[model samples]
Target: MASQAMKITLERIALFQFTPTHCAQARAMLGWSVEELSREAGVSVEAIERFEAKREVLDVTRLTLAYRFEAEGLVFFPGFAPGRGMNVKGSTPNPMARADFAMVE
Candidate 1:
């Protein structure tokens, strides 16, 4: 079985793929037109059109798509490593932590 995060990742990818009703759903949920989403997400309206029609998309755009949905949960896995998990907005911690250093007198 895949890890939970991996499973969620696959599920989101699927939702993004077969039947991108999610985009339409997102439009309805967010009250934005496809053109608006495309602009905010820095993608093309034609690309959004194609995504709605064909469910296929560029790897690079996947992150933007999640942002457009306000689906921060979907952003976690792809943008982050397995153990570290997601980062809350406005909080900047080093992804890789280190033990605090001390000086011996």
Candidate 2:
């Protein structure tokens, strides 16, 4: 049977783009295997493999992975930010929390 496509949600969207490096690093720090991550994130192991291999996957897959990591206290930062990377929670304050988003006129 053909598998169902992943669904997109607001949680999948974040201020920073989640990369394969982040996924690997977060998994390492959490001491989680791909299967463990799949169980936690409710994502497929194949999807996690594709993502960690730096292969293109669905947007929802990437987002879901990021969301799962973030929920586990992993912070993801984009490149170009000085001294920024996946960090454990409480190392630095969250710079772009959703509540911080405000419409500017």
Native-referenced Cα lDDT, model 2: 0.61
What's the C-alpha lDDT at position 8 in model 1? 62
Candidate 2 pairs with clashing backbones: none
Model 2, 1-105: lDDT tens digits are 122222223334342557787788788888899999877776789888988898877765666667667666666666622222455543213322423122100
What is the Å distance of residue 79 in model 2 from its true position? 3.1
lDDT of each: 0.49, 0.61
Residue 61 local lDDT, model 2: 61
Q: lDDT per residue, candidate 1, 1-105, as tens digits?
A: 568688568546744442355556656555689878766666678777877786666644543554445432222232332122154331112211212111100
TM-scores of all candidate predictions against the true structure: 0.48, 0.61
When summed lDDT is taken over every stretch of 10 residues in candidate 1, the lowest stretch is 96-105
